[model samples]
Target: MTDVVSEPTTVTGVDTPPASPARGRWDADEHGWFGDFGGRWIPEALVAALEELTVAWKDAMADESFLAELDAVGREYAGLPSPLYEAKALSEKAGVRVLLKREDLLHTGAHKIRNVLGQALLTKRMGKKRVIAETGAGQHGVASATAAAFFGLDCTVYMGAVDTRRQALNVARMRLLGAEVIPVESGSATLKDAINEAMRDWVASVDETAYLFGTAAGPHPFPSLVQSFTRGIGDEARAQCLERYGRLPDAVAACVGGGSNAIGLFTAFLDDPDVAVWGFEAGGDGVDTDRHAATIVGGGAGVLHGSRTMILADSDGQTVESHSVSAGLDYPGVGPQHAHLAATGRASYEAVTDTEAMDALALLARTEGIIPAIESAHAIAGALRIGPRLAAEHGPDALLLVNLSGRGDKDMVTATRWFGLDPETATTDPVGDPDSDPRA
Candidate 1:
């Protein structure tokens, strides 16, 4: 990065601009930033709703009373300022300095809670009585349910039948939180189907309900809204990294499941050209195989569920199935901002295989005593693959921060069975069919 003198600025509350164009694109009047590919591409019916949401969010951002209430809830109820843990043990094992942003410690055990809370607050202010959302790993479902219970609102979570079957515990948790969990059996019976169902509900009940989208994808305000709500992760991580280390980390990494967590951590560091941003997408069997969810790495432009983003679509533009070890990372599309970031060379996207992510899961558990969600394991996988490359190319002193997006408590049973581990006994490697082991 080239250094230059600052310029005089006249805007009352705005800071002076950097000497160079922002590494990521920004709209001063719109108050939205893009990497070059993000914009609203949706049906006409959603335009009004999205514009309303944008206006409401801007108002909330400016409302001191709303900010005070949100701040109090975040601190006293949702546990803000989650720890930026120094992963000394894992760092030693990886041969790189690694830090983990413990978003898992937040209420409902994932970063999804942050967006849900902010959106739910807006829902309340909008005088909506019902909140609807879609979930994959059930993280967002659980988070929405938690928020609904906290604010005394009706919550409905649409999940695919496959997800409900795979994440039974999360289903029960949502029920316990007083939410109605409806399983969508149409289409592939996965996240996409659930999203379609939620959109239908939203379109029908736009007057009485608010749809709290789970990730930084979907229509207009969602990518921007979720990013704003999740920016705290990066904000805290940036400050903590500076305080702990003498400077910013060489790179920040996270898994890109609809790209919420990635965008969250990436936004704060976007202006810093020296720091690299990496997003790991799930490579289920392998990127070479037919069954992977690496949309950014292996997909093409197409519209899906109201957004014009890169999706796993066939040549005819039909949506295709996606596979991943973690349900959360199995979506066929990613947030448009991520697509833009990739297009502009502002960020890099990599695919992490199921075997690789599972290996990362075990490595983090044994080496750091912290079991991360499969979604987060993708970041660990990225660290393993990218850490050595960066160290060899840059230097050994290069710093790496992996967003440990969520804990793995919800995945124990599934992981155990998938790895063929005896529930009663300790295990190291995950279970796989010997005949199905592609590496073998």
Candidate 2:
């Protein structure tokens, strides 16, 4: 069961995970099983390739030169050690000393690049000349294309037809990065569809291509590998918290879709007995309405996208379509590590409605002058819901670190539609005067 900070109960009650060295351990078994959540469930055609990747990954883990190269690339190119900014205005509103790990400032935007650069480096080690990936919101695709361009490797990104139309700016960004963008028309024409198409490509091109998984929900090595690279988000925040606040935070929150960002932050605080980790999921209409992506709350255990974890699936084990205003958080399943963390009570998972996320997006924009990507807004929503509660429970000094995962420039159109602001006049309008706006 998880510890409860008595207040408004923004997060549900669960038994706290026990304090043990192994309770929140990271590495999976050789087969990549994370307590039955991760393992290669791919067809026979890709097994050998995966095994080779597993071995090379192990070697890369021990190679000091490889690590130094990765660190150099992260700092000099992709922008590691992203600032931990005090959200003073939002903090005052929330009644907690809130800090944001600003991943939004990193090159190519968002936390996706942390894993992309690492995987691209590994691609060279594997002697692969081509890299392929799937994207929903297109941030990952842009990051992947940037990495491939840097490495001079051929890159292809599969995106849903619907997503390309919605997130077209990112589509153009990916194209400009010289990556081929393939629009998938199957199924719901979203992330899962893109994944299906990418998997087919991998099956046929395994020898020359590495399937660079976009998030942390895939088979074993990917879940672990992506987290290993992006854990820098948490690592930097952990140190920065100590330097700035002189103590660990009461809680850390991040939005969970396929859960790369959340896992990146959570893995850093797993062993800290006092630091609680929380994950907020997308609640489209609301989790109770069955139109949401609150997988941990409304879903059952099932296999999806090559991993066995919490999933939004029907009785026959077919994955359900998830909806959210935030395309990035609209997945049917979460990473295996998140499932284990939730099951063991190492963390609590909550849902924020689309309205709540949009409200938080606007709140941060007005109060802090930062427009969070809609996916990151879920974390902002959690802060708003949990901050006052923490103050009530832990007093005024309650500190919280939120992963500010991406900037919201990509969501201006969505924000414009959600808040009903005229794009032509909204930029010059005063910040807090939503009443002066046409929507009011």
Candidate 3:
């Protein structure tokens, strides 16, 4: 791995600017390379736009007024500093203390709002009147639309046709927010396809529109920018943990799709060697099978969606379609920074199967009365799976922090199909007797 610079220079069209103050240990270097993983890989037409964005990002980060505006908007509108709740019942069940970083309570019911608001503000700063985005499970799309409406920017979201059907509620929500929703039917008709379409639109409309890339996986400035906006998750959780429990968590866990939430939660803890960072990928069925989105666990290093990262690809290095019960976790590639972290042994990643994740969703709902998004369920499942080992190693005092990245309201359709909650389609009573005791 390349040694990271304390203060790295920023990249312009061809020249390099002087070193700017570092945002964090994991911030990418000049040219946007995160170690060997991230760098701009795109058509020549998009280079100017990326260069513009890179400069804007560096300037915004250095601007006190911009920082204050973002913070004020976050606290006043998006619900900043979300609560850290100790899941007593879950802790008892897992044999280790479990603390949940409740990002699900944020506006639009997901952590995607943080990045959206930041990029939306950036769009305004750049004097852009329109914003475009791509989404998988639709949380990011909804968040983007919400931000655009709030900021009075024209919003357009490209979503997978499959996702539009599965996550219909969120698609509707986005439309109701006055954003135009376009369903991409090409490729796997999923996140990857949506991104391709969005990128195509961005290349054509670079001057008047800003592409609000959903996750931290995209090229260059996006990975760093998304991390900067969402790292508040870790910053808040770290302080909350210190204040509430007097120490950092023994382990920090989050589900990794394109890796924004995991990176967000892992950022503040990366320098703390004693704290283990764990990322759970979506294992649709299982990793042993071909149907899974477990990029780090099952994939090799390759470029996908403009960044060199671990990807689900076939023998000829072609991208494979990834499957997952949760739409948000259905992706073939991960963020370049996650690739760097795993490569350097600063973090560990594992695949959580669909069955395991659903079981965890049910467990959390019954135990804590909190129905987490399926993406977040993967983290909960991973925490449960590793809890015993943590307990054995650290005794009963082992504490695990799991990022609840989103609420499950948008996932009811998928969860209903998975859990057989609908009587019309019921083959078996998945929830047990309706007449029985509610807690039983």
Off by over 4 Å in 2: 1-24, 423-440
Which prediction has more favorable TM-score, 2 or 3?
Answer: 3
Candidate 2 TM-score versus the reference: 0.92
lDDT of each: 0.83, 0.86, 0.89
Residue 33 error, candidate 2, Å: 1.9
lDDT of 2 by residue, 13-74 (tens): 22222222222355477777787677877787888888888788878978999999999999
Q: How many backbone clashes does candidate 3 have?
A: 0
Best-performing candidate as measured by lDDT: 3
Off by over 4 Å in 1: 1-36, 423-440
Candidate 3 Cα errors over 4 Å, as ranges: 1-21, 424-429, 432-440
Candidate 2 local lDDT, residue 20: 24
Q: After superposition, how far is residue 185 of candidate 1 from its true place, in Å?
A: 1.3
| Candidate 1 structure quality by residue, lDDT tens digits, 51-150 | 8888888788789898788878888998998999888767765567888999988888888888898999988988889999999979999999999999
| lDDT, candidate 3, at 214 | 91
Clashing pairs in 3: none
